[model samples]
Target chain A: MRNVKGPEIKSVEDLIGPLARVRPGRPGGEVSGTGARTLLASVTAEEPTGRTAGDVPVPAAVRRYGLRRLTLGAAAVVLAAGFVVGPSLLEDGSGGAASYANSAVAIEREGGDYVARIKDPFAEREEFGEAFAALGLKVGLNLSPASPGAVGEIFRVGTSGGGVGRGFVAGTEPSGCSPSEPGCVMVLRVPADFTGEAWIELGRQARPGEAYRNHGSAVGRYGELRGTDVDGRPVEEVLAEVRRRGLQVEFQRIIVGDGGSLSFEAVTAGEVGPAWTVWDAEAAMAGKVRLMVTPEKLDDNPMYEPGLGPGGLDDLGESDEPGKSGEPGRSGGG
Target chain B: MSDDRPARFEAVYREAYGRITAYAARRCDSPQDAADVVAETFAVAWRRVDELPKGQEAVLWLYGVARNVLANHRRGETLRRARSAGLDAEMADLYAAPADRGVEMSVIAEVFRNLSEDDRELLSLVAWEGLEREEIATMMGLSRNAVRIRLHRARRRFSRALAAAGVPFGMERRMVPAGRSL
Candidate 1:
């Protein structure tokens, strides 16, 4: 916690301590030309047929699934948090919930007769206050940005004003972007001494669960990099840590496609980032992990799992032609 | 150092790509933008690895590069909300709303709205981006502790914004309610 101003890797190591373990899965695989071709063909479903993968491709179904294959289609959804709405968007992974990367938490709790909509974007501070005003509940804004090296120092700094919400909100003047820019989420707080129920609403558009924002694009679906050195820290333990900190996530349904593939996220730390953040990864990519952004949306969308295929609904006209999951670059088996 | 640049570049790139990209994503306006930042930083290091002193010192050099990249990036955009100078004004009414990163960033804007463009740069370099206080000081041409104190007060102002807006108090329960915008 002392301000030693250590090396970048050292600092990053201190921030994450160690990456929690990656959930069990093969993060990377051979992307052969055939595979690429298949992926290209697979995403060619132009309309929705609502027939499931085995049936013919309905125009409507192909149309429905076509969006998944478009370049940037993935991050478009994550960024939708800047815009869209849905219950699936409210899943907050705090209290060591690390696997559900970038997921926010929103819960409507029964507070007396009124419903308290509590949400923790884990990014903004004022929403805590707004969440309070909306639901008439006291709020606790946990400001934990993932950092390295100075974990103790960072913790001290975070705990500086007593505890999380106990202290006043820290203000940041926009250094580069304007208040109108994206990172402008605000913070609101009630005195820790105040008495009332508290609830948080957390959610982001489910548009991009197929690919969480890993390194720019949603292609970050692959995970489980054991035994890698990050910012001077050993990350073999990150996998376990991910399990340890991952919040219990319950998918509406877990499915395996005709080919036996399913993307499951393993997390660590409830979404509020870690206790601290590390501006590393260059020295040793701390806090950052690789993931395979597949063509899977959360429960918000109506369709079969990636295993199910793009033509499941029969609403979109899809045919037995193997490449029609609306998924970009995938193999189809009827 | 130049001779060893490639080795260091590979080592650093192999290990740091994801996290650095994530950092860039968090800081930059877009993923493509973030990628450009990460990619460009490494590109620079590849060219000047020899100049980067060994060990932890190399890391600082990397930071310098990233800082430059970010500064350059912002400068190019030309949409700084506030303009000009002057900010001895006790940054009162700083309201931080938990917007999405689970922390309300808008509040940072509300509270720091009164600060001159320079002050936001000075404070954000430390508070939001997680840069060292001294590093921020160096970047902004300010004294070390002076930056620290300003940052501390900035946080306080943000906290006050929460109180004045009364957004975080009881509003949490009804987020995106039946009436409000989703």
Candidate 2:
């Protein structure tokens, strides 16, 4: 087997820095001392109640085994009834249960709206669809891999038939909960009586080798090149920094076509001269960077207008607008 | 054995608290969440102190617990078991500090974050936690070969994804020769 050690990329500690540098108290001393004492007290208090490690809920086994059907007896009945009565029963107010939960998802009817909390984001799409279908919803949930900032965000929605009035809204449970953070769940709220056939696509963690359908800029806050200014710099200077970081570099020659149309073409190292002007640099992948260059300096940076910075593009070829019905869109870094 | 549980827990807490706090801080978005994970992880450690491994291995055990706690927290299953105002304050201050953000850094972070959860965790165990392959295999309950294979696959996937995003070249597979054009 090949050695697992690869390039010397920045570690998470190097990227985020130490806790003491960011805070006042020592992490293990005063701060954790108080926390440890408090937690010990809480645990001691709970010990009288006979709560043990077994009492603490372990992560659901659903992740290990794929999606399991709704097993709650009452919830199962409600879902079974839904399959029999169909969607019309929900509007009649005769549906016995107003909520149902499985290992995969939990959906509740909140007045005129149906609130669904996605429990297993990696679960099969059919499982999500089944949960919605149980509530008599004609909604289809398609989860696609997205960049870090775009995960758990709804990127596209497409409706075909009737009854979509204003369509549905998709968001996180606690308003702006970061998907990577705790206590955050992806939420989809649809009007209870929506009769239209709708397809909703939400961003989920990408599988290995899967391409991210939704893209965020590699620059700016939380981006790879946060403070580096490569725009309008000499290729020689930028290449030196790239080499210094022990990172591989790739070059994209920016060609300005007629009518201000822009296109990028890959050029070999021999083709790109040291004096070529680099208009922009983007993180192409781990251990590698891509520099957008031109043989001569242009009047303005074609990648962005003045003062907009990284994600601010001045119409570089294709449209960058997001949430265009069926198309995957690019989102700015959060 | 039961009488010495408190002393053992204290020793482990004092030894591993800083690193555990850093671990949670790097992965969590908020200080409160990180605090909760740290507190809960130790609480579990206290409860199951018998299962806590000896000496340095204890920290690895706590990391495994913290990982599970974080997973539960992400699913919204972990109820707030231990909440300390002081710890929360400390975490808030830590988060308030400025990160080394840049366009390239953001892209790298995005690519890193975009990786599969398993891949991210495997890489983080090495990079963030600074664990060796044998240690990772022990913590993850896998054989050394399993760790080696998984880590290799994760690195390759990360490189491929970065290239697909237009960030060319895999560090392991595509090292550019010196004096060659970019």
Please report the candidate that would top TM-score against the real structure. 2
Which candidate has the top score in DockQ? Answer: 2
In the range A1-334, model 1's lDDT, one tens digit per residue, is 2112222211111211111111111111123335323432333322222233322111111111001111111111111112123323232333111111123323232211112222233346464444333332344443332112111011111111112222221211232112223564322222322233332221211121232211111011111222122111122232233344341221112234446443223323332122222111110123233322122333321122222333233222221111122243321101
Candidate that would win on lDDT: 2
What TM-score would every model get versus the actual structure?
0.27, 0.38
In candidate 2 chain A, where is summed lDDT lowest over 10 consecutive residues?
Answer: A61-70
- lDDT, candidate 1, B124-173, per-residue tens: 44333345543443333333324433543444344455457543432332
Model 2 residue runs over 4 Å out of place are A1-103, A134-138, A157-170, A191-199, A206-211, A234-296, A305-334, B1-182
